[model samples]
Target chain A: MPHLAVNNLRAKYGALEVLKGVSFSIEKGQVVALVGPSGSGKSTVLRTLVGLTPVTGGNVTIHDDKIDYASSGSLRRARDQMAIVFQQYNLFQNMRIIDNVTVAPVKIKKRPKDEARADAERLLAMVGLADKLNAFPDQLSGGQQQRVAIARALALHPEILLLDEVTSALDPELVNEVLDSIRQLAKDGMTMILVSHEMAFVREVADKVVFMDGGSVVEEGLPEVLFDAPKTDRAREFFGKILRH
Target chain B: MERILEQIPRFFTADNMALLLQSAGLTLAMTVAGCVIGFGLAFVLVYLRQTPGRWALPLRVICVAYVEVFRRIPFIVVIYLVLFFIQTVASNASLFTIAVISICIYAIAYTAEIIRGGLESVPLTQMEAARAMNFGRLRTLVTITLPQAWPVILPPAIAFAVSFIKDTALVSQIGVFELTFRGKELNNQGYSGILVFGTIAMCYFLMSFPLSMLGQYLEKRLATPRSEQSARKIRRT
Candidate 1:
């Protein structure tokens, strides 16, 4: 069974529907890259999955347990099993990097302070931020901040991770450091669903590429097939415009 | 001017000085009581305004109404209303009770608005980040939002508190026997206006100056960039 499945997911912000019956599934170890143009509901899908966007319709199943989007308890339970890294690195500005990584485990999971701190140290080490543990978010470069965010997400021990344009906000030269950390996670078999505009990074790291447009999946397949061959005129035009840029 | 300066020494006679001291004590007591009560009510008002739910909606509307009505009216009028209004309900209400309640009622409206501004100054993304980390709303508010909002909240609150110190003079209208009331009595007894008024004004200045200085000091210290603070702390360690 798929580790996570989003079936007929519908979401909106007041009158405007952003995700219209979007469906996708991720197995336990697969990295699914969601690629699309701006406002194509790619990021909305991730937001909906995390229960930030109120789901107007449909259901999500995690590990074979299904729940409606409106149930707070079930949604929170589902959310506790996953984590997200945003386009803007929303680190707690008041906290040191180590505290930022450890806060969730200690507060939400009720882990002991020492255990949480040790876990945070280990995760910081994993993300190449061991020396910066005492630093604040504002003290670091954008790439370092994003890497800290990734370590924070991993600190939760989420079964699946969500990356919403993680490197899009970085300077071009700083993009590789964050993408490299994500690539290393992919190598270590961390399941992640990423929404990205960096077609090259998506192609390199994504095992299965899903093409989205106008709030629906246009085409999805292996990266080689989707990138090289045209299954649909819309996707082909999208790739043509993106690659030409 | 020479006569006024000479009179200042006579104003410190034992009886006059004792009344001035007692009145100053009362003024300090009223300011402290008003701040404690007003801040508590303002906290409730801000929480109601910010929280989402059907139950909180009416309470929030009531809070908005409370802030608007109290803020728009004069503090002296509120004091008069509370003082006279209390007499109709209870003939023997203490001046202390009337003074604290009136100042608190007036300060709550202003404090609520100032605190709401502080709350809004915190970025929306901060709350979203906290929620995504599986934090409950209360924990997110106390731990994540309040710490960031503190720097923004403090200066205004201190300003209000110092203003409350001056505002306590208005309570003298209801025979609270505070500094200004004692000044009026001393003036009635043939004390020079310069001596009586100057003494009360000096007392007011003494009370408010330290608080304003503290506000300025905190604004400068907290205004330093978070990264700079962390770096400085790291160096210290």
Candidate 2:
């Protein structure tokens, strides 16, 4: 069975529908990149998975544990196995870097402070933020903050990590550092579904590429197959427009 | 100026000074109790406003109504109503009890609004981030939302506290014999109104000035950069 599967997911903001019937699945240790034009419901797909956006109709399953989107208990249980890092890096401005990474483990998982602290230190070290343990989010550059956000997500020991345009907000120069940390995670065999605009990085890191438009999956295949050879005209057009710029 | 200075000593006669001290204590007691208790009520109001599900709709409506009614109506009017109404129904209730209840009701409304503003100022992503990490609702509020909102909440909360101390003066209308009421009594007993009222004003200033300064101090302390705070700690070590 696929490690994570989202089927016929339907979500809306209000009167406007964003995700009509989006579907995708990822195997264990697989890295899938979701690329699409703006408002293609790429980020919303991640939000719905994490329970930040409510799914009107859908079924999300992890390792044969199925959750109907309408049920709160199922959503909560499914979300525990998953974590998301947002584009803006959304670090708690009130906490130090160490505290930011440790808070979820200690507060949610009921881990001891010392144990959580050690884990946070290890995760921060992984992201190259070990020296800045006491620094505030505001003190770090945009890229460093995003790395801390990644370490924070990792501290939860999530089986699946979701990246919602994680590097879109960075400077052109700073993007690589954040991407490199993600590359390290991929090397470690972490399962991730990333929504990104960085086409080159997506092509390099993703095992599978899913192209979406108008709130539905247009075409998806292996990166080389999808990027190099287009099966659908919509995919061909999207690649044509985005690759030119 | 000479007359006012002379009256200061007269006001400090052992009996008069005792009464002044007693009234000062009562005023401080009521304000502190009101503030602390009202803060509890405000917490409930804020939670009710944020709760989800069907019951939350009515709870939110009730919270909005409670805030609007208590905030829009004058505290003095509320005190008068509580004082006279309680007298008719429960003659044995102490005036002090009635006074504290009245002040708390008024303070709860304003405090709830200030707290709500603080909560709203916190970015929605903070809650999302906490929830994404599997933190439950109450845990998210306590651990993530509240801590972030606290710095924003403090200044307004303390400003309200200072104003709360002043608002206690309104309770004097119910004959509670707190500082302002006692000041009036002293004035009626043949001291110049200027001397008597001015002294009370100074006492209010003494209480409020420190509170305002404490608010300033807390804001600065909390605002200190974490890096600097850690660096300072390291230097001391």
Candidate 3:
């Protein structure tokens, strides 16, 4: 059984329907990359999955547990099972690097401070930020901030991690550091749904590539199948433009 | 100067000194009580943004009106209005209680606005990040939002305390014998008006200067850094 499933998900912002009847599922330990042009609702899928954006209509089930939008308990449990790394690194500015990672564990999970701190430190070390345990978010570079965001997400021990254009905000030089960390996470078998325009990173790291255009999945297949052999004219055009550079 | 020095002992004789001390206590008590009430209400007003339903607007409007009315009215007029109107209903209440309660009412309104500003200054992204972590609304507020908001709120709050201390002079109109009121009484006694007023001014300065310094220190300490160290730490680790 798939670890996560979204069947016919529909979401809107007032009258503007951004995600219209979207559907997808991820097996345990699979890395699914959501590729798309700007304004294609790729990020919306990740946001809706976390319940940040309310679904107008749909079913999102994780580990065979049905997520009911109306039930606070179930919704919270579903949310806890997943973590998201934003396009812009969203580290809590007030907290130190380790504290940013340890906060959810200590405060929400009710773990003791020492235990949470240790876990946070370990996660930071795993993300290559061991020396920055006491440093604040503002003290780090953009790539460092994104990695701390990853570490912060991992500290929760989430079943799935959502990456929404995680490297889009970084400088050209900083992009490689963040993408390298993500590639490492994929290699370690963490289930990830990534929304990105970095075609090369997506091609290299994604186990399955999903191409979306205008709020719908335009094409999807194994990275090689989608990139090398195009079935749709839109996919062919997109690939032609993306691979040319 | 010699005449002023001689008059100091007469001016602050036992009974008068007692009254002055009592007044000082009342002034501090009023300031503290008002600030507490104001901060509490302001938290509610600002947190109303997170509350569901259409009534949030009405609640916000009412809070705005409370802030506007008290902030516009002179503290002297407010003290007199409350004393004259409320004394009829609570006839046994002491003048000290009336003065403190009036100050509290006035201070709460302004403090609420100050707190509201602090709460608003916290970026929405922080709250969203907390939510993504699956923290319940209340827990997120306590741990993430408030902790972050406090550093921003403290400087203005300390500034408010300085102003509140100075505003205590308005209580003299209602016959509170705080330093300013004592100075006025000494002035009425004649011969050392400049000395008495100057001493009172120095007392106000002494009361406010430390708090001003504290506000400046906190503002400096809480300043947000420009670099993104979290990202760097991530790379190094």
Candidate 4:
């Protein structure tokens, strides 16, 4: 069975429906990249999965356990199993980098403080930020902040990670550092669903590319198949436009 | 000028000075009681006002209407209303309690706006990040939102309370024996109007100056994020 399955998922922002019966699935250890133009609801799918967006219709399951968005217990369970990194990094401006990574584990998960701190140190070092643990979010470069955000999410020990345009806000020169951290995660068999506009990074790291347009999946397959020879005209046009430059 | 000089000795007599001291202390007491309690209730008001969903629609409307109505009413009118309302209900509520209730009602309306603005100033993404981590709404508020919001909230909140040190003079209309009421009594007793009122003004200044200085110190202290402060502490150590 797939580790996660989204069937006919629907969500809306007030009067406008952003995710119109979108469906996809991710097996354990597979990285699925959701790529599309702006406002295509690619990020909304990730938001809905984490219960940020109210899921208006349909269902999502992890490890074959269905999530009932209306039930707080179920939604909380889903959130505990999945973590999302946002485009803006959204680190707690009040917290040092070390606290940012360890806050949830120690405070919410009720782990011992020393254990959380040690894990935070390990994760921060993994993301190439061991020395800057005491720095504030504003003190770091955008790429460094995003890497810290990743470490923060990892400290939660989520079963599946979600990346919503993680590197979209970075300067071009700073993009590689974050991408390198994600690439290293992918190599270690971590499952992630990423929404990205960086076609090359998506091509490099995504195990399967799911092409989305107008609030639904247009085409999805292996990265080579989907990128080189999309079955849908919409996907072909989108890839043609973005990949051209 | 000679009349004023002679009135100074009379105005500064032990009995009169004691009355002024007592009145000034009363003024400070009511302002602190009213503002601190009101500031806390304003947090509850803002939280209730932000409650989402159709079920909470009426609650949100009530919260918003309370802020709007209280803010639009004059402070003196609120004092009279609270005084009469409390008298009708209990018939024995102290004048000090009535004064505090009036100031609290006024402070809640104004500080609620200040607090709501401060909470909104923290980006929505911060709350979202907390929510995704299974942090409950209240925990997200206390742990995440409130910490970041303190800098934005404190300066304006302290300013409101200090300005309110003067506004509470209106509470004297109901015979609270506070600064203004005592000043009026002293003036009525054949003292120089200039001496009595001028001394009263100095008392007001004396109370507000230290409080505003404290406000400035707090603003500067909290404006530096705890992360940076800890880093500095590490370097010093």
Candidate 5:
């Protein structure tokens, strides 16, 4: 059985169904990338998994435990197992960098402040932001702030990390600093579901690439197969268009 | 002019000065107590108003109605309603309490919108980040949302409170011994209108000017760049 299975998951924003029976599975320690054109609902899958978007139909199972989105307790448990870094690097603007990383761990997880701070320092160091511990989010560059967001997510000790177009909002020159941090996480064998437009980065890090369009999966396979030689016309056209740059 | 000049000496008497001082204190107390309580309660109202379920529709409606209805009604009308409503329930409730309640009711309505706007000014992504980390609603609010919202909320909130100090005169209609009521009382006692009211005006100015200055200071402080604040902190040490 897969470690985490999203079987025919569905969601909607009012009458517009965004995730029409999307299904995928992730084994432990594997990096999966969700790639597609804008508004193809690539991000919605991660959102539904974390309960940010309400799951209108279907379910997710982790180790065969079907997540009940209706129950706050179940959702909390699911959230505890996964942490998502947003595309905008939504660091709490009120907090300093160290506080941003340690807040969830200390406040929500009820972990010891000392241990959480130590782990936070380690995570910041890992993301190459050790000297920026006291700085506010607005004080840093976009790439630095994005790295802090990644460190913030890592401090939670989540089994699965969701990166929702983490570098999509960065300057071209600033993009690699963030991707480099994610590359380090990938090297450490962190389980992550990445939604990205960077075809090269996706190919470099993704164990499997799930290509979605019009709110459902069109094709998914090893990154090599999907990128070098796509199966479907849609996948071929998407890769062909995006890869030309 | 001669009449006013003669009355100025009488008005400057220690007894009259004491009364005016006391009245000014009462006005400040009414504004601070009412607006502080009301501002706090507005958070609860905004929270209820944003409840996201079909079952909470009535709750959302009720919260919305409270803000809408109270905000639309004049402050003086709210004063009278609260004055009479409380009198019916507990006749012994002091006029000061009644006046505070009136101002609080009005403040809650006005500040609810201010607070809601401030909270909304924070991008939805901040809350989403907090939610994905398993931060409960109240925790996210207290820990994340409210702190970030302070910059947007405070200047306007303080402005309301400072302005509401003048509005507290309307409560004197129910015979609260606030500045305006006391001014009227002194005028009724044959003190010149210009003399008594001019002093009362001075008292109101004394009360609100400092508060407005504090509000401005806070606005500047909250808007200061974080780097500057850190530099100041380091310099202070």
Candidate 6:
């Protein structure tokens, strides 16, 4: 069994079915990039993995333990194993950078405050935010804030990290810094699932690239196989439009 | 006009001025006490788990009804009801205590509504981010939610405090010697009702004007930053 598996995942918002029987599996230490156009339910898949969005019908098994959405207690237990970095960089604006990174470890993990603070300092240093420990989210640039957010996600020591269009909200100049941090994490053997529009970053970092369209997976293969040569006409057309830019 | 000038000395007599000072003290005491209790209860009302099935719901409903009922009736009537009617039923209650209790209850209702509006104005995203950090619900509310909400809530809260002080005059109807009562007493004693009332209005203006200015200062201070601090830091580097 893979480290994370989504078997026949179905999700709906009110009456509209956004994800229809989507199935995929990711092995441990594999960096899989889910690439698709807008409204392809790519972000929704990451959300469902964390139980942020209610999964209508699906089996999301993380390391052999299935997430039970009906039971919040069980879902919370399952969620502790993974971390998610949002496109919006949802860093707590009211908290200082160190506090934002340390909060979950201290509160949820019940780690000592001193230990959590020390861990946070190390994580911030890792993300090139060593001097921004006392700064608030609003006090940081978009790149710095996203770096802080990535550090916050890593502080949990999660088995799998979900990146939902992490660099889409950033300026063109700032995108490389965030992508560099992610590439470093991948080099350190962290299993990551990214939903991003940065095709160049996707080509460089992802071991396997999965193309999703209209709430279902259209194609999945190694980046070389998928990017350099197209098996399907839909994949070829989609790749042509995005690669030209 | 000359005779009235002689009467001004009598108006400022030691005993009369002492009574006026005492009234001012009592009014301040009542207003401050009411504000603290009212705001405290209102905080709970706004954030406490009072949904239909929660244990807090009944208490919340009771609190809501209490506020609505007291808020609708005039303050004078509420004071009168507490002093005369409640006193008749539960004798041995101190009149001073009754007056203070009535004002606090009235203040809670209005303050709760103001606080509820402030609480609602806080984006749900703030709370969700706090939750993602795994902070307990109560911790999230106090440290994350309340701090941000306070700057928004403070102006209206101060405005309510000023209004509460003005409303203290209504308690004089139940025989509390607030500023208005002193003015009324002076008027009855041939001190010229216009001059006495004018002085009373001046006293209120003195108290309320400073607070209104403070509210404006706070509102300006709490205005969301226009220049992005993050972008500025990046430019400096």
* TM-score for all models, in order of appearance: 0.95, 0.94, 0.87, 0.96, 0.96, 0.88
lDDT of 3 at A16: 90
Query: Predicted candidate 1: what Cα RMSD to the true structure?
Result: 1.8
> Chain A TM-score for each candidate, in the given order?
0.97, 0.97, 0.97, 0.99, 0.98, 0.98
Clashing pairs in 6: A140-B230
Off by over 4 Å in 1: B1-6, B88-92, B231-237
Count of clashes, each model: 0, 0, 16, 0, 0, 1
Candidate 6 Cα errors over 4 Å, as ranges = A228-234, B1-3, B49-85, B224-237
Ranking the candidates on TM-score from highest down gives: 5, 4, 1, 2, 6, 3
Ranking by DockQ: 5, 1, 2, 4, 3, 6
Worst 10 residues of 4 chain B by lDDT: B222-231
Docking class for model 4 is: medium
Compared with the real two-chain complex, what DockQ does model 6 have?
A: 0.33
TM-score, candidate number 1? 0.95
Candidates' lDDT values, in order?
0.89, 0.90, 0.82, 0.94, 0.93, 0.83
Q: Candidate 2, A207: how far from true, in Å?
A: 1.4
Superior by DockQ: candidate 1 or candidate 3 = 1
lDDT of 2: 0.90
**Preferred candidate (lDDT higher): 1 or 5:** 5
Where model 3 places Cα greater than 4 Å from the true spot, the runs are A112-114, B1-22, B54-61, B188-196, B224-237
The superposed Cα distance between candidate 3 and the true structure at residue B68, in angstroms, equals 4.1
| Residue-level lDDT for A195 in candidate 2 | 96
Q: Write the per-residue lDDT of candidate 1 for residues B1-237, one digit (tens) a residue.
A: 887878877878898888888889889989988987898899877887777767778877888899999999988999999989999999798989999999889889999988888888989888888888878877887888889988998888988898889988888888989999989999998888878899889999988898899989998888989867767887999
Give the DockQ-based CAPRI class for model 3: medium
